[model samples]
Target: MTDVEAQQAHWAATFAAHPEMYGGQPSAPGAYAVELFVREGCRTVLELGAGQGRDTLAFLRAGLRVTALDYAAEALAGIEQSAGADAERLATVAADVRRPLPLPDASVDAVYSHMLLNMALTTPELEALAAEIRRVLRPGGLHVYTVRHTGDAHCGAGTALGDGMFENGGFVVHFFDRALVDRLATGCTLLDLTPFEEGDLPRRLWRVTLRREGP
Candidate 1:
């Protein structure tokens, strides 16, 4: 299998082995996105890489309609199963992020992701992904995403895979730099950028908030 295919298979196996891999609680970025979206009067949220639906549940509990997207079918099922009372408000989509997002233009009020942008995607792919996100948002919609930046402890710790990506323990991470972040925000309004950390290793990250500019 190619590296991309291997990565997918590895994640599938990993999730299967440990259903609660990232635990059931939402990440710090997830909570932040919830507050931002709610305070901004957002009605719909598109959560990319909604792993195990921890953050998705948080959004639902906050009374926000969330469409959770993950390439793994098992992850989608986990979201659906764990949604419980919030299932009615949760829609899960299983598809690869390498391709165009399967949603209509100007459909969502917000696009929120936690570490989704720091995946194994190349720089060009990330640029395209940002464009796709901007297209799916309403004129004044928001896109809150977090990524592990070059400043992270593991940023350069693993096997170099080119384009700021490094593979460690069968998984690949595309660490971001300010230049790439700024480039991705070309058509959008860069609202906020906050640095934070997560996990036992305390992975450092940058929480970025971008708004689609319009009336």
Candidate 2:
């Protein structure tokens, strides 16, 4: 199988085996995004990697319309099922984020993703994804995404896959450096870059916030 295809299969199997692999609770970044979105009066959110719908549920409970996108169809189904009373305010899409997002221009109030930007995608693909995020966001709309940075404990660990990506424990991660973060900020105004930690391994990450500019 191709590298991307293989990674997809791995994630599918991993999700099936673990069910709520990352737990059912919202992530720190997810919770933060909800608070920020609320304060910004964001009515709709498009989450790039809504694994198990943890953050998806958070947005729903906060009364924000959410569209959760992931490559795994089963995960999307699980989100819809788990949505329960919030299902009406939730939408799910199963597609690769590396490609163009299936949304019209200036469609969403905000975009959020937790660790989705650091997946097996290449640098060029990441730039494209950022552009796609810009296209879907209305003027002054916000985009918040987190990524493991080069300072992470496992940044250079395990198999090297080139372009800052490494495969350790069967999962590929693209460890970002500031230069890359700057490069991807093209066509958008970089708002915030916060360094943080997560999990037992204490993965080092950067929570990046960007704002789309009007033409």
Candidate 3:
């Protein structure tokens, strides 16, 4: 299998084996994104890589409509289970974000993703995804995403997976530097880029917020 295919298979198996891999609680970054959305009056949201629906549930509970997308079927299943009565407000789509998203242009008021941009994607793929995200958001909409930065402890300490990507603990991650983040913010006004840590190893991350500009 190619690297991409291998990574896909690995994620499928991993999610199937551990449905609660990320636990049932929403992440701090995810909760913060929701708070920002509420403050900005964003009602419709597109959640990329909505693993286990932990964050999706948080959004739904906050009375926001969420379109949750994850490549793993197991992850989508977990989303369905957690949605429950709120399933009416939550739509689940199984899709790989590296490809064209099945969403209409200027459809959502905001886009929220946690640790999705730092996946096993190349620079070009990441750029394409960013452009697609811009297309799907209405003018002046917000985009909140988190990525693993170069300063992370596992960045260069794991087995090399080519193209600045590393395989650590059976997970492949593409580390992003400040330059790459700036490049990815093309076509959007970058509002903020803040550093934060999560996980037992204190996985370092860059929480980026951007706004789509008008034509």
Candidate 4:
């Protein structure tokens, strides 16, 4: 199988084995994204890589309509189960973000993702995904994502997967630097990029927020 296929399989198995791998609590970045969504009066949100529906639950609890997408079917299943009564407000889709998103143009008020952009995607793939994100977001819509920066402890510690990517524990990650972050924002106006830490190891991350212009 190709590298992408291998990565996909690995993620599927990983999520199947550990449905709540990241637990139910939303990440700090995700909470902050939700705050921005509320402040911007965003009612519809598209959540990419919605593992275990952690952030999806948070968004639903905030009374926002969320379209959650994840490559792993098991993850989506977990999301659906966790949504329960709030399932009416959540739509789950199984999709790989490296390809064109299965969403309509200007369909969502905001896009939120946590640590999804820093996956095993190449630079070109990242650019394409960014363009698709811009296409799906309405005018003045926000795109908030987080990535492990080059300064992270695991930046170059794992087996090399080419294109600044590394594979560890059957998972591949592409560490991002400032230049890569800038390249990924080709189609949007980057509003803010700040550093933050999370988890027991205190993983260093770059929380990036962008806006699709033209109202």
Number of the predicted model whose lDDT against the real structure is largest:
2
lDDT (C-alpha, whole model) for all candidates: 0.90, 0.92, 0.90, 0.88
lDDT at 78, model 2 = 94
**Clashing pairs counted in every model:** 0, 0, 0, 0
**Model 4 Cα lDDT, one tens digit per residue, 146-189:** 99988988888879978889887777889998998888787679
- After aligning candidate 3 to the native by TM-score, how far in Å is the CA of 74 from where it should be? 2.5
Better of 1 and 4 by lDDT: 1
Model 1 pairs whose backbones collide: none
104-214, model 2: which lDDT tens digit per residue? Answer: 999999999998888888888888998999999999999999999999999999999899999999999999999999999888899999999999999999999998888
| Candidate 4: count of backbone clashes, pairs at least 3 residues apart or interchain | 0
Candidate 2 pairs with clashing backbones: none
Query: What does the lDDT read for residue 196 in candidate 4?
Result: 93
Q: Write the per-residue lDDT of candidate 3 for residues 105-145, one digit (tens) a residue.
A: 99999999998887888989999999999999999999999
Kindly indicate the candidate among 1 and 2 with the higher TM-score.
2
